[model samples]
Target: MKNELNRNYSEVTEFILLGFRTSPEVQIPLFLLFLLIYMVIVAGNISMLVVIKTDSRLHTPMYFFLRNLSYLDLCYSTVIAPKTLATFLSRGKQISYNGCATQFFFFALFIGTEGFLLAVMAYDRFSAIRSPFLYTVCMSQKACVRLVIGSYICGCINSMIQTGFTFSLRFCGENRLDHFFCDVPALIKISCVDTFVNEIILFILSALIIITTTAVILVSYAYILSTVLKIPSTCGRNKTFSTCSSHITVVSLFYGTVFFMYAQPGAISSPEKSKIIAVFYTLIIPMLNPLIYSLRNREVKNAVKRILFRKKSFH
Candidate 1:
């Protein structure tokens, strides 16, 4: 009841995001750097989406998930990158309460969707490698569509819960968020009321999302690895491993940073360290996804080559 009373007297209308407290000399340079990264993230993800859509040969269950992943990365980058860039360029980095809440919602939505999608992709690989003959029947068009839709639904549900709980807290004073964006942990840190319930909810949700996804990915890869080892020819084994390696690399990069950020005790979290880690997953990873997939996956490379050849011929 006291908590309810505290909530009734909410005070903060806006938050000033103290984004990366760097020297004045470096602010412009930092802004330019992030602006460049944002542009690359946009171009790379869009190109991958276009290439996958246009090339009939690329329209498999794998590429279907890849297309969704690209779209997620695109949206994810937009949620954080532009705001971070603006903070670097401008003197005042104030975000209205509504604006902050909206950012947190989409950020949670896309991040959760990506986590689920990565697990789904791992399962897709497992089916392809372990049950080659049954791969088509296993990952049918309807099944693929359902999996993608399910990911989005899960993301929406999780984000709604997270956003609701985080915003319910009464943030009365100290509206200065010591992070580049309005993340849940950052918001919870500033609330005047007891946030024990919010923290428990955050921990449980993070554990469920991170653990379940990581477990699925690990189990899928375990079976995948066993199946790959059983292949007779060394060349075939190498090719199979190559196909799985890109996904593994990306998963490692993403899950490592995210787990450290959310899964740890908030008392141990340093805003400076969190900001750097956030930059990696939120900005660098999205830009790197296309490069990693395209450079490593032979089919994507060939598709890009084909598209370029056709364009050159036309010109």
Candidate 2:
């Protein structure tokens, strides 16, 4: 009974998200733009997933990682984009407190998962490029599956820890969140209780994740570059460089937005400023992912062509 009473009084049922600004001029344009972007992101990621799933040619370790990345994009967008779109349309942009926390929890989950998965992808590339003779042995079907699973598992655990800490914070006053989504920094700013410990924990965790993932990616690319340079055939070197370039571009975009948004202290990282940067990772990147990979990859293009031809024949 004591625990129930404390829970009932302690928990906040709702929160107001200040959402960019309250002007009609801004809201309409923002809404339309985000809606279009959301559609494109969903369409692009889904197309990639479908292409990978149906095509026999794409049943390789690389495409498997790409498929997982696409899936993560879908999950990541779903966590924030719909709510953001709704907030734009609504005059009163209020979300239930539980709802806000829930959103943040899932958002953190996928963001962390993507980071780890990207690192795994980097290692996969490293193995492929640096150890061609042992590449198949190193990245076997069982190993790839385990690596992907491990990334997600680690992400889930990390998110749970972060969310638990975030929820323990007290927010009795100023319920308005400065950002569009229920981000940790925005939420922490409005907490009525002490937030020093929470902020430190979050900061340390964020640093660990970004630092570890970036280090792995950088090291992998270094070895990859060395191996590519050692190729005796110019054509082979060119092909290897081309393949790694797309992955590197995607990884750079992902980590760049992440570092800009979360890797700094709140004193330095402005919520308003970060929100703009956040759009790249949240909306634009997902839409661009399929285009970057598909256009660059001959195998994906051929699969797409075959699929289109099959549709024409059926008609």
Candidate 3:
């Protein structure tokens, strides 16, 4: 009876995140593992940013976008990693109502902005490869700055709408959120009122952003593929393909998971499965991004070597 009174929308003040439902013995292991992963996520992204900023050779539009990508990855992981780490160690996984809103807003902002930025990178690749002579004029530094600013602005506006859309609903129901973080689908699932309209609007807005960004990538790559096929020499073809390979790889990783989570209907059918997938894209992907770029891209490797040699010379 007392619980029922406290759970009403007027009275509810916090949410308890039910993290992973694994066995008790695994909690410590998971905690340790996530803590290490979070550390790597921070270190890797910061290193990427530092390398890009210091290396004069990396001062191109491509690396400019890459720099922002690392920044977003860092911000995205930090938003959830601390809270997630807390859930594993402590019994109290309670988050205030405002805290959840802040988390959702920032998460949505970075994720949304990153998606748009990838499309811009794709456009960058397309221009460089398809029209080398015009590439400089097309992707001039000032133009690149505007493009990035526009992406963030779009993300911020959409984030506000999505955040307001989700949090405006009454939560006179269960306070135990199934997932480790506050996400659109998860919050929608727990609303006390009729969420049919809210779900549609949210899904539509999310889909609009995903689909629009994806279209830019697809169209850009299609042109790129055609242009690449026309190159006569084998070595030339290989070089052209290599230029955009890292961008395409990251694009595939990001879009694949995002599409599965948001685009598909009835995604919340298996909460455990959703959580596992969420762990991959949200936490694991950020850690892998720096490694992916540094390992696969020849220029990044060269830059790291140059920086190390310079530091050694200084010492």
Candidate 4:
């Protein structure tokens, strides 16, 4: 009987991900729409990464973080995009056990890194704006690289702990995940083993992430605002505001969707609601990030114009 039971358990290899609705009418349209979105997102992020790498003027600490952020956005989208694109076509969404775990691992890592990276960028801006004389000393190249590396390392460690806890849970029978992606909350709900420990750890991690990132961003912006107010020239004020506004907007969009999705009570968050928010985080934000930053920053525009002019001359 024990051997038979072990065989039955081992036979469960794949998991069915019940992604979105089953209506034929909706699936095709959604697939086309998400395909367009995925293309745009990939293109936008790649362009930003290329621009940062090629442009000498963008070698500052702020742009360094922006480059890292672009990379993170690319990675963050990759974790969810292909699977999401496939979902629009597959009659029933199916993700293998190992595949799901891999998704969760990278997803957690990049998203967590993004939070820390944004905070670091905000601090960079704050130092530049508030302590213009000390900006170089404060955000030196070595220091900036170290900070970004530290953020990535922290994210990796945090993700390992979370994924480790999640993987430790014994999944017995029900293999159907109600949502599109392999999210922690959705996966934990169906675990045959107790998830109390997971919940507590998740809560602690969530609180630490929110509190630490929020504190850093808030303090940075507070200093920035103070410096902005002191600027006597209207043009200077506007320029400063324009420079930071795009970053603020992207930050709000990314954090707002994440906080809303995770901080809310599970009882009130339906699968449909989760899908809507996930769309913002996974697709829309990645696509818009490059647009927002490039359009607002004068440096990027001039670089693009020069690049296009060079192309024209060559042709």
* Over 4 Å off, model 4: 1-12, 267-269
Q: Candidate 3, TM-score vs. the true structure? A: 0.95
List, residue by residue over 83-173, the lDDT tens digit for candidate 2. Answer: 9999998878899988987998898899899999999989988998878899889999999999999999989988999889888887664
**Model 1 lDDT, residue 136, Cα:** 98
Ranking of all predicted structures according to TM-score, beginning with the best and ending with the worst: 1, 3, 2, 4
Q: Candidate 3 local accuracy as lDDT? A: 0.88
Per-residue lDDT of candidate 4, residues 1-315 (tens digit) = 112243245333557887776688988888888889888888988998888887788888888999999899999898998998787787668889889889999999998999899899898998898778999999999999999998999899889998999877766667788888888877777677667788778777866886798899989999899889998999999999998999899989988988877665562237778878888998899899999999998988887887778789998
- Using lDDT, rank the candidates from best to worst: 1, 3, 2, 4
lDDT per residue (tens digit) for residues 44-100 in model 3: 999999999999999999999999999999998899999999999879899998999
Worst 10-residue lDDT window for candidate 1 reads 1-10
lDDT of 1: 0.92
Q: What residue pairs are clashing in model 3?
A: none
Looking at candidate 3, the ten consecutive residues that score lowest on lDDT are 1-10
Cα error, residue 11 of model 3, in Å, equals 3.3
Q: What TM-score would every model get versus the actual structure?
A: 0.96, 0.94, 0.95, 0.93
Higher-scoring candidate on lDDT, 2 or 3: 3
After superposing candidate 3 on the true structure, give the runs of residues whose Cα lies further than 4 Å from its correct spot.
Answer: 1-10
Q: Tens digit of lDDT per residue, candidate 1, span 1-315?
A: 224455566599999999888899999998999999999999999999999999999999999999999999999889998888889877889999999999999999999999999999999998998779999999999999999999999999999999999999888767999999999777887788887888788888988999999999999999988888898999999999889999999999999988888887653247778888889999999999999999999999999999999999998
Q: After superposition, how far is residue 110 of candidate 4 from its true place, in Å?
A: 0.5
Best candidate (score: lDDT): 1
Cα lDDT, model 3, residue 86: 94
